[model samples]
Target: WARHGIMTTNLAEAYNAILRKLRPLPLTAIVEGIMYRTTMWMRTRRAVTLQQMSNAQTPFCKKMAEYLQEKANKARFHTVITIGNIRQRWEVTCRTKGGFGSSTGVITHEVTLGHESDNTCSCSCNKPKLLHKPCSHVLAACAKIKLDSTSYVSTFYLKDRVLNV
Candidate 1:
């Protein structure tokens, strides 16, 4: 997936998997079947999104929200040290994880506030630079500094953007 920091040719593979059941059907029948399935999926997803909005729970479209939450959970095990520099730098140490294995048994990353007015933080892990999503280190730094971690998230992951699409 895009959030995992790399995109590959799996899209065509996924489409091929979707086309498996339609193989025996005529061309028109296959096209109609795909359309019907796509329509149903869209309707169901839209309904779910509407329900989420009604309940005041849709922070982001479900998948991105879950991904962010998983990173937030990891933030709890982080030790964020403010570096107090011009760039508002921070050192985030992973106490319970080995994102990059270290001989000392703790992984650390340097995080800095982005140049933009919006608080788009970046990490030494390079995930934010690559995937357009804040890595756990950035999230941890934001948490320590009382910044809203969500502000660092890419607009591509925003719920409103997804809904409009």
Candidate 2:
């Protein structure tokens, strides 16, 4: 924002100064440091509230919101489900969206199912694209069918790994 001239040098300097005090710390320390800074800064506002934070209507705030939304949009999912009898089969699902105009925009999904006898999931997402946990969609589907979703989740994978990767 400073480079784009959207913010003044003085404002950038203040942010940098606070960051300097935070940069040398470990991840947890840096998070706590920033949390303290945020508390102090909000205290100066006199009327800060959850509504105010949620209502960040400035252009910069909107851009930040869009960026975070993009990050969340890139998550992947994997899981096992009871398809026949008491037998379990693995499934993988991926989601992606692209395009400009509403008419041209499209949301794409690729889902794969695994065979128990072969110990393989048929979805492309199940290959080198391994996810750390079952997606909520799979969990929801299981719940809708009165099945235990937890039994399908592998303890080794987390949403963050599936999302970040």
Best by TM-score: 1
What candidate 2 gets wrong by more than 4 Å, as runs, is 1-129, 157-165
lDDT of 2 by residue, 68-128 (tens): 3343343323233444444444232333345443454533223332332332223333321
- Superposed on all Cα atoms, the candidates' RMSDs to the truth, in angstroms, are 3.7, 14.6
lDDT of each: 0.78, 0.42
Question: Which run of 10 residues does model 1 get worst, by summed lDDT?
Answer: 50-59
- Give the Cα error of residue 8 in candidate 2, in Å: 40
| After superposition, candidate 1 runs with Cα above 4 Å error | 1-7, 57-59, 95-102, 129-131
What TM-score, to 2 decimals, does candidate 2 have? 0.25
